[model samples]
Target: MNKQFIVNLPVRQLDKSKAFFSALGFSFKAEFTNENAAFMIVVEDCIYAMLTTEPFFQSLTGKPVARATEANEVVLCLSCESREEVDSLIAKAAAAGARIPHPAEDHGFMYDQGFEDIDGHLWNLVWTESQA
Candidate 1:
């Protein structure tokens, strides 16, 4: 069986975040699409918990969402088959409206970059030496 994983993210604007990931070629699973949130399919192995602002998500967690710049709660790491793939996704994310996390860095054995979604969620795109 294919084990499924889900990551819930608090978003100020559901539609905006949905559109952003959509631009990056991700599609929502219709069954999980709703007014409060949209389930974004990152890949067969991953899913995003794209939550709406206010009562929708707040009521569930009973707390404020973490600011990406202020916290290091978690960084979602995803693998790529090659360095070019990591580079491509970073470019695509910038075009899709995500704030670039940092300049691309290399460590001889790995390459990586990232961006913050509208909701302050961090996605780490990586390409390892094995992939290179």
Candidate 2:
């Protein structure tokens, strides 16, 4: 059986968030979209970024949403093919107006970079020897 994953994130404006991610090369599954949320496909792994309004998200969890800018409860990590691939993606994100966390890390064994999406959702794009 194939496994699938969907990471739900709270957004202030669904349309804006959808556009932002679309610019980053993620396409939405219209069948899973609604006024309250959208299911954006990240890769063929059945990964979906479920963007829901803040109010609707709050309904799912009573606790206050962690400001993804200050800190993130979840770090959406993805593996890349090479160090160059990692660098290219980070550069593209910066061009898209995303903020890169200071102090990029690189060791022989691993390479990882962090960025904050427009709505402050943190995503970690990483590449490791094994993944490469």
Candidate 3:
């Protein structure tokens, strides 16, 4: 059996969320995009993030959407090819209005940095050395 991962996140506005992620070099699937939500293609068809309006998201989950600014949800992490790539991606996110929540940490074998998106979703960019 084949399986894929799709993360659902609530956004106050679809267009704004689309733009924010686009600026960070993400693209959406036109077939899954509508006025209320967008299927952000995180890694082609293997991974995706469904950015949906609060009301729509709430309906699907049968619960009130958590105010991203006031509550902790889940942190999304992405692997990068190199430490430079991690820094570069975080820099782009920051330039696109994301807030850097903390400084980048270098642990000799791994480097990690974090940023909060426009909707207050925390994302960690990491680059790790291959074990010998």
- Whose TM-score is greatest here? 3
| lDDT leader | 3
**In model 1, where do residues sit more than 4 Å from their true spots?**
45-48
Q: Give one digit per residue, the lDDT tens place, for model 1 in 30-106.
A: 88788888888877664455556546777888887666657876888988888899988888889988889699889
Q: Report the Cα lDDT for residue 125, model 1.
A: 93
- What ordering of candidates by lDDT runs from best to worst? 3, 2, 1
Predicted candidate 2 versus true structure: per-residue lDDT over 1-132, tens digit per residue: 689998999998899888878767778989989999999898876677899998889999997877777775777888778888778778877778788877569887898887888889888887788744
RMSD of 2: 2.0
Model 1: pairs clashing at backbone N, Cα or C within 3 Å = none
20-108 per-residue lDDT for model 3 (tens digits): 89988999999989998999998875889999999999999798889878888989998889999898889889999899999999999
RMSD of each: 2.2, 2.0, 1.2
| Candidate 2 accuracy as lDDT | 0.83
Q: State candidate 3's TM-score.
A: 0.95
User: How many residue pairs collide in each prediction?
Assistant: 0, 0, 0
For each candidate, give its TM-score against the true structure. Answer: 0.86, 0.86, 0.95
